[model samples]
Target: MGGYVRATPMAVQADEGVPPSTSLPDIGAASFGAGDVTVETVHLPDDRVQITNTAAYPWRVHCSLHVTAADNSEWIGTGWFIGPHTLITAGHVVCIKHSGVPGRDGWVRSIRVMPGRNGATLPYGSVTSTNFWSVKGWFESGDQNYDYGAIIIPTELGSNTGWFGFGNWSDAELLSTVGNISGYPGDKPAGTQWYAARGISSVNALKVHYDIDTAGGQSGSAVYRVLNGNRYGFAVHAYGGATTNSGTRITRQVYDNFVAWKA
Candidate 1:
């Protein structure tokens, strides 16, 4: 089970609802095919998205990255800026190379992240990086349980752009009750699959979980719980469990480390 396995692409079923919010592009109609599996956008009149999807108020850093396959083709996942130059992602979305392999180092390249992206094809604000950090101990040894990593953006994301802060690990219940997952699902194509899912705090609270279905491409999405009906990212996409495939969960340890990283 420890051996490298083919990655599964993250996918959300097509939503046939009224459509998405006016703020976001009509991703459901513009991209995904028709099916019974339609994802309701953040703007649903009845659905309350204090933690996960809709914009309760303003916004902050927008995280972005390129997912390259062995064939050289690539897809992208979007994350928000958690710290200055530090963006979090699901470990599986971005590949990890263990030590002792010649020319096989674990890091991210050709990476670009933009803060505060709008409906435009490109980012309204963008930042790129040359260095990244994973859980130091887990990277050295393959540990799926701690599947999280950080990208060191050389540029400053700057204040007033909605840089994020971490929640105290002591309150896991706050995370469990309300939360949401946002990311670019790879199956839909660039600038086409951005979406959000309503989430509930996972049983452990260390990780965030929800009924929002996802596929392989959506691995490293930011999982946040509601604080006063506002979304604050607590975990980066690590992986989903074997049993409950409804959505992916992000662990607390991975999130805590990234929040504490400096320089």
Candidate 2:
């Protein structure tokens, strides 16, 4: 259900709250209307560009996540580093719900993180982590408003790969923002990254909607902006639809969670 999800930690196995994956991980988000959750909407002309150089600064900081769900199912999502060992993503990426299956709603078994990965090439190697974190709003109840999380990796890869700084923004401030999203999408060659940028389409108390082009594997990718030469993420990419794509907005509470979780 997510990454840009923070799995900067590797999971050893499915944990007590592991969730099952019945389809694409995107099933765990919210939309403006009752749209199909699994479909990845792209505007005409497909403005997303494939990121070729995996060793660059910010591009290198973004990671591709391969998750093994509690039911032994495999799913792909994206994540970006925020600290030496902390990576952020969508909550459903760590704990899933409403899969309509028995005994499949819980924490994932494992997640393999590959940073700055090009197709068939892993620039910074990889890490498999079991350590995951989410809030009660998501785990105890499948609340879309709280659908974001993190992963803690054993290694301090972010020191080398570096990371993005995220912050909370007021809706008024966001109205004038142009956001960026880049991640490995499942529709392309595996492990490949794609990039897009556009003015934010809309913003709410809990979500930020954009017209940026994205696909399934991009869930949990950072919805960020370059302010004063540094990357500041304001949302965690989550849902997609015919009208727009969205991410969990970095509200004050969500920002505090990142500060507390980042290490």
Per-residue CA lDDT of candidate 2, range 1-263, in tens? 22123323442543222222222443243221143464356777799998899889989999988877777767888889999999998888887776655555678777778889887677787777888988777777767778888988878988989999999878888879899999877777777889999999899889898899988778789999999999999999987878888888998888888988894
Q: Assess candidate 2 and give its lDDT.
A: 0.79
Best candidate, lDDT? 2
Name the TM-score of candidate 2. 0.87
TM-score of 1: 0.62
Q: After superposition, how far is residue 176 of candidate 1 from its true place, in Å?
A: 4.7
For 160-263, candidate 1 gives per-residue lDDT tens digits of 35565555444456434545555554444343335454545354533444545444444566666657755566655544333332222344454446655534
